[model samples]
Target: MTMRRTDVVIVGGGLIGAWTAFFLARRGRKVVLVEKGVVGAQSSGTNFGNLRLQGRFPGQYPLSLRAQALWEDIEELIGDRCEFDPSGHLYIAFNDAEREKLEKYAAVSESHGLAIEHLGAADLARRYPWLSGKAVAATFSPRDATANPRLVTPAVARAAKALGVEVVEQCTVMQARREAAGFVLETADGRSFGCDHLVNAAGAWAGEIAQMFGEGAPLFPAGPPQFVTEPFPYFIRPSVQAVDGTVIFRQIPRGNVILAGYPRTAADPIRNRAPVPPAKTLAAMRHLTAVVPALRDCHVIRVWSGIEGYLPDMIPVIGPSMTTDGLFHAFGFCGHGFQIGPGVGLCLSEMICDGSTETPLDPFSIARFRGAVAEDEKFRREFDLPAAAR
Candidate 1:
């Protein structure tokens, strides 16, 4: 068995892991990233690419704001456009209750310096004629956008490799243990590596790594269904989501309409592959058409899903481990990690390099779940989308 040592070892090759490796390597730290599959071959690569910030968790807004800045300059950093589109994003309301929710969210989010414009029925109809009449009111955030999930992670990995970061693919971490000096990780292929610091950016599988250090995070693996329609003339520009969070759809410059919402996909987490059933696809399309009536004619050409770690509170766990030193975690993003992935990578990097970051990490710390079941339940109910209320 070959033995290796490095300054840091990252346990996943998704967006956060790859970006962390890139940043660390750029800082002259010897970094090694290992992945069971190809980089970005999971949720980080398969999501709807909705880089939105309209309705982020209150505590996540600061970090999300930093992420938006990185997305704006991502091409310069990664050497590729990654299909980032700044056309904007819209949240529509279909009823009075939905409108009230939109208003409340807008009011709170705007206070945090996020620019959100409210549009009533008449204004919405005049601005976005493609929307269905059921859209009684809407909110628009010009800064929220989209990116090509399939491109971002791989591009970042390549960039990291160019910076001398070792990326090992098709290597599964068989075992991990903390030593007096640092941590040692063994792979299924009989490769052993030691690092002074470890990052658990394992996406859906992150809870497994945290458990190795005695951290118990109640993270559930979920595969959200996503589908894309056959190419048509491009009409929709900005991405759109329902106020109740039941529907989300966006149009790419290529005219392919990508859609996703909250119904979990029937997935086998072990294989990391989830085939979207016909009924689920149809159900998602029905929700789409309710928002954009013209989409009723669009035929979906493909469907897929990716494994994502969802916490009970719908927030990610990002901070130092509670039980171990020299260990950091950035995982369980629930369903909205794609939009804030870059910022997350940067934040983890800062914590490692400078021991702190300008963005606050108190809310996302793993310690929050240490012994607070009642608080966790309350936050879960508060953050659960209406679609999941059932």
Candidate 2:
């Protein structure tokens, strides 16, 4: 019955937990981060890696921008760039309706202090000669970027460890209960942790922890199907996405074009699996070729997916628990967590250490789930709700 005590215990090792641990450690807090598996082996490591600033939830701009600043200085902060590329993001519209959507999105982004360049068909053709002429309009965000998802979480975890945070991997928290002084977390391996504050950043599995505190969210698990083409000559500069949500692709400096398709695939968190169906892969290929005619003959080298939690409202639970003191949650990002991971961590650390953060996190409070959460329109378009939720 070895019991390790710490000032803070984070129950997930994905980007959010890693960043939170890092920030807490930087602030001189004795912290313990426990991960069921290796760091970033889940959604944090398998996402499309788009650090997109445009077309984000209006409420997320401040946080996203804050995270972007950290990312821009990543090498200085963590001594690793993790293949971050500020290649920008181009949102293309193939029809009038999609063009209007692009215009509106651009307006919203501009209002939020993001610079967006609206491009007409001719302008797009001139700027991106390889782009298909079918695109009637487009908007480009120069600050949008991409990074290697596989490298980020581990690098951040390593950085956290260098800063004196104890990172426990291959360990699962079997039970968590609040005590009078603090909280106690029991691990499957017969170790216990007592912490004054607890953070639930367990990705798709975080809802169960919330339930233990008498709070519940309509959080479901799903993953976007992703594919990468065999290395070809590098031509595409910016990450390209269709406004219609059919396909999004970006070419890395190494010449591989990584792409992600929508209508997220079903995920099984119990088994820790998110399989990419072959049919979905083929459809993604077709969509990719349709958008970029030059890639019509490109061969896909691999396909994959990762389990991610989705709330009905398509936002995340990112504030203190409603029923518990010293318990915070930052999960259910609905595939948009990567870019905001750092900011969420910094905010959580601020909340824990300074008692508050400047970011407006009221919209992400767990209290929102006390009432029926109206599904966001994007949720309907981006995911096939589970039968139980439907």
Which model scores highest in TM-score?
Answer: 2
What is residue 290's positional error in candidate 2, in angstroms?
A: 0.7
Span of 10 residues, lowest total lDDT, candidate 1: 375-384
164-236, model 1: which lDDT tens digit per residue?
9999999989888899978999899899999999999999888888888888788777678888999989999
Candidate 1: misplaced stretches above 4 Å?
Answer: 374-390
**Model 1 accuracy (lDDT, Cα):** 0.86
Among these predictions, the greatest lDDT belongs to 2
Using alpha carbons, what is the TM-score of model 1? Answer: 0.95
How many pairs collide in each candidate, listed in order?
0, 0
Query: What TM-scores do the predictions have?
Result: 0.95, 0.98
Instruction: Check candidate 2 and list the clashing pairs.
Output: none
Q: For model 2, what is the alpha-carbon lDDT of residue 259?
A: 96
As a TM-score, model 2 comes out at 0.98
